[model samples]
Target: MSRLNRSRSFLWLAGTVGVTLLGSLIPLTTNNRFYYYDDTQAGAFGIWFEIGTKLSAGEWPLFSDTAWGAGNYAAEGQWGIWNPLVLLIGWLASTSPNIVVFSTVLKITCLCVLAAGTFLLAGSYKARPEWAAIAGVAVTLTGFTVYIDAASWVTGLMVFSLLPLAWFGLRRMAFAGGNPILALVAAYVLITIGYVHGTLMLAVLFLGLFAEAWLTARSRNVMFRLLLAGMVCGFIALAVYLPGVLTAPVTARTGGIANSGFLTPDLTGLATVWVPGSLPQITGWWGGFAPVPLLYVAWFLPVLAIVDYGRMWAGGKELAAIGVFGLLSLGLTLAPSDLGPLRFPIRLMPYVSLALLLGAAVLLSRYRVAVLSRGRLAVTAAIVISGLYLAWSQYPSIRMAAAFGLLSVAGIGGLYFLLFSPRAAPRLKSPAATAAGVILVSLVVAAGQHAAFKASPLPDYRMPDTPQAYSRQLPGAEGGTFVVGDPTKLGSQIWNETLASNAWYLNSAQVQNLYSPIMFAKYAEDLCITSHGWTCSSAGRKLFETDPATGKVLADLLSLDTVQILRDPAATSDDIFRDGPPAGWHESSRSADAVVWMRDRPLLNTGQVVWASDGTRLSLVSENSQEVVLRVDGLDGGSGKAVLSRLAWPGYSAQGASLAAPLRGYLVELDIPANSVGKSITLRFEPPAWPAVVGSIIIAIVVSLGWSLGELVLLRRRRPDKAWADRAMAEPVKAVSPQ
Candidate 1:
């Protein structure tokens, strides 16, 4: 290819990737909170927010050695295990809270990395501008992009957005027999730091890489080295991964009770990952935004890319795409979330899908001739299969099915003749024919999938509109205590102190027995004897009543120190405050939710003041505001009752009752008290942990200096003879490293 052509191709790639990234960022940035059941995505955002909060407080977000099932969503004082890279990014952005700006910057950075990587990968296939752009769009618009709920997951999504770039490098390394070891290390490390689910994805990538390398390497040592590099990265990734995995068994057990057959399907439900309509409730118009058509069509792209797959394989790229897609697909279908567990495959699928599509694009570009005809046929078949599956899944919504079914059929018919049997001389193998085929296939697939992709509606629910909203409204009272009516109670009174609102907390009459640990521990013997009613003890009542009482019981409950609550917009004065405090004294705070007066305030009547020294008579010494002295007759003999007036808080030596000092060293003594000798007391000191703080700052400085030094070395070492054009083309064609 000419230099002009290459430059144009690069420009086209830049434009396409830029546009796709911008589009993806739009929805992510706009939605302050997004609606989705994918907790992994939500967890990513939560991790970032927590890290941001921690960094703002001048602390590193360290891994806490603890796990609590119930308070996972409760932001403050929740479980604290975070991916380091994610913590680093959020910490970097802690200086500002304008999430939009932070997210935009990160998203752009991810895109630049992606584009550079793609350019390198595509250069291997000598892909044209148009073909490369198609690949870019396909990746940008895929279902994975939806994971970016801008408010919480900007960093995770940004990290995820770099997968294609990494894969591109992987491909180059394999083809050129270059030192891919470093690239492998960097890629795995970044993924590990980027998200918790990265382990699963990394697993798939490793498996794929191993398979690809073994099949292509000329020597046993090369294969061993590749596997060794992967093993090293795996060990490093495990540093963060082991903790997340440890918490999973507990998380699954706690979440298992919400397992509705419809909501949490068994083997049948697992199939829905591939088939669109199996879960119609999650269908586009219902709640799912991943259009049935789009997912279906995407699956077919790899099949169409088979022609290019042949060419790439012949050229030594190794046929890894098929193996990758197949492995991920199998895992998704078999991985259990509730049965035994929602295993690693659940996390692996999203990234695996990206590799699948990228491989397809590479193949499509290589066999441009076959892509026009055979590619269309394969895509058409895929659309048909997807449409059928979607319609089957939504069997009740037959009218909806009919509409999509007809369109899918007609699409296949139109594309079939264009490839297998053309109207005039069948301009097969011609550039124009092939180009036209590519255009038609791309349009049809995109349009078909777009039709289905538009299904996930913006959830109308907001804070207070749903149960999840309750956590958001909790606020801290003056003393850092907040009362909230638990939303789980059925027919229970909802006394939302914040906005003073009421809803049936949980309909208790409908739910007779509360299945809580407090109930089980306290009343288990009695309930077994009488076989009875809702016999809730004081602890059980605390466990059960939020606003209303929900029927089900929680095995474990983690209490919050502070909470903010939102009042229902429709609420009036009559809603929440009707019922007086239930068996407890009520004291209201200036703040709405600050009401506190439990009948049994445990610490009410129990404290004593004692003298630190036994003294007979005492004299006082007045010093600066930071010091004081007490004089006693017993100072010489050490045995007399010297009364010291206004003594300082116990720890310091009280000059008299009115004075004290915090320093431990000796001071000037006052005489006159005998009984004041040997009475012990307590004192308070407020010293900063300076050594630890200074050490952290020093480490930051060292890292910054090292990065600068490394950059200088890399710049000096860059290949001198390589031209802009040669570097641009060659960078993407050979295996590269972070150094």
Candidate 2:
């Protein structure tokens, strides 16, 4: 590497980091609050925090009784429990749990990781310092990243951050024989899917790579090696992937959910990332002009890449087209047919952001704008603008079409310098000038946008710490059904103070719960709605209005025993004594945050063996969350049902009797014979045993490690084996460390 390159690298780091800090100065500097972005406040951050804490305490995560009867942890796609990082957080949370601190740190880590990944990937192409830095900074600045950070989509953040590195690895393997970094990053991503825009986002990344191999690698051997690299990546993370796929269908995620469509490209949003601070990523459309600066970096960068394509292609550049595929996806999103039912078009933003930045890197590598004729720049700009306009026209409504059309015209206007300017230098001054212009425009646009439409700030309130921060204690609540407050206040408390609330919003909620099939569904129900109006599931909510005769019966049927009436400041006007507490319950005690209530007739052991013929309900001797024991007079010669008070999921059985899958969404009912009544019968929710999963995980780890170790040994031996794609005398591929 040249001394110039090294210097450029350092400069890129400083400039990009400095600008990022400027963009996020408000949240970082504000001591009164940290970024929460509401959507993730309860669903993502608080829930994950609680999972970590519980994991640290040695609690079984797979089957949770906190919210509904059986919340499957491993099958919850977003949990990514198999990922080492998530597990580490869980472990850390157990010792010192602070949601704000953990969330803030994680968010920062993701941002830095993304910057590093972008830099490394861009630099790998031997791009000049200016180009590489621009690539890193530009991707980090876009609306894709802004919304992701605002919503606190930590999984998406982690995935996007690591994406460039993964692509870098893939690039090396496909173009430069093979690399270890590819395997490691692939494993990390496969283990954790949420960061790269959830499931569909991950699919796009793979598709983008597939396209790279299809277009760039002419050699079938190279393609096969790429395929092998993918296999290796999957194998390394198979422990998590295998179980996740298997249980997803039976649980909440059945068929992939249809969440795609309706994200038309905003031409002016092309430069949204250039805005200083939080301006670029601010929420709500400011009529598409909140951050408008009359000039944008988007106009300069794409045109730069378009004109520099001759040189980039000469450099054996396959990634250039691969990156642009991100935009192609946006066009597909405009189609009502759906991109095979992807999550959303905006979900493709991370890829789009990466691709656009890569294109910029190509243009900035040399910054010899003088090489391009005005005719060429103008033609290229016209073509690019045409594509965007076509996509905008596909929008379902005229309102959208007009909005996007306006942006296209505005974007075209911003390209004046690129197409017609004669002042551009042909050397170092060109790149330096371009970089300065991008930074200045970004800052100006961001500041302007903030001045126009500031995103709602993170709440000034702290994470719940005092007793008012916790749910009221119920002796019968643990390992049983319980409700904290009325339907209105049910899920509110889950994300407010606690990391993991007793809720069923976790993935594997049975797609009926989330209205999906193949894709992972995070939570279930709408008793508690998000600020965005997405209804979430919470079995912990009090009945709408306790049905006098049916409330207690239904509660007993679902094992609902305790209720905690939260003292809401807003609810002070409502009669807590009447509206809050359910019937057939007495006040236990009061806490800073809640007034405790216990059912006069507790349903702690609701599982009972009933003689069907006689219609006599027998008493349950003992029961836990997963198992219930009932003694029936089997010699009495009456067939019966072992009624367990819990929601029915697959894998439940009654020992020494037949188990009938519950219909009509009722409690699990098991058939019992009068002959066996004298004997003690046990009903247990026996999902797939942990030993098999543990064993498979162990085998997967062993295989992956053994392969990695072999690769390391091969690296030391320096063999140029053609078995994997490299030809004899070709330079052995450089080994990449596990990221």
> lDDT for each of the candidates?
0.38, 0.48
TM-score of each: 0.57, 0.72
RMSD of 2: 8.1
Expressed as tens digits, the lDDT of each residue in 1-739 for candidate 1 is: 4677567656766666665555444443334333221222223333454466557767554421111111122111122233345566656644434433554556556655554555455454445444455555545444434432222234345555555555555554444433444355346445445354544455566677677666665557556545644554555444433433333432212233222222222333332332322233222223432223223223234235235334454674455544664567555523454334332233343454455555555555445343245544576466456545644664446654555455445543544445345463556534335434444444443344444443233232122323333332323222112233322232223324322111111111112121111111222332221111122222223432432121211111112122222222343565332333443334333233233333323211101111223334433333222233344434454543221111112122333333323111111112233354443322211112323323433443354345335535665665322243334342332211111
Candidate 2 TM-score, true structure as reference: 0.72
User: Mind giving the per-residue lDDT tens digits that candidate 2 earns over 334-415?
Assistant: 3332333233344555666577677566444533344455566677566555544443332223553344335434443444
Model 2, CA-based lDDT: 0.48
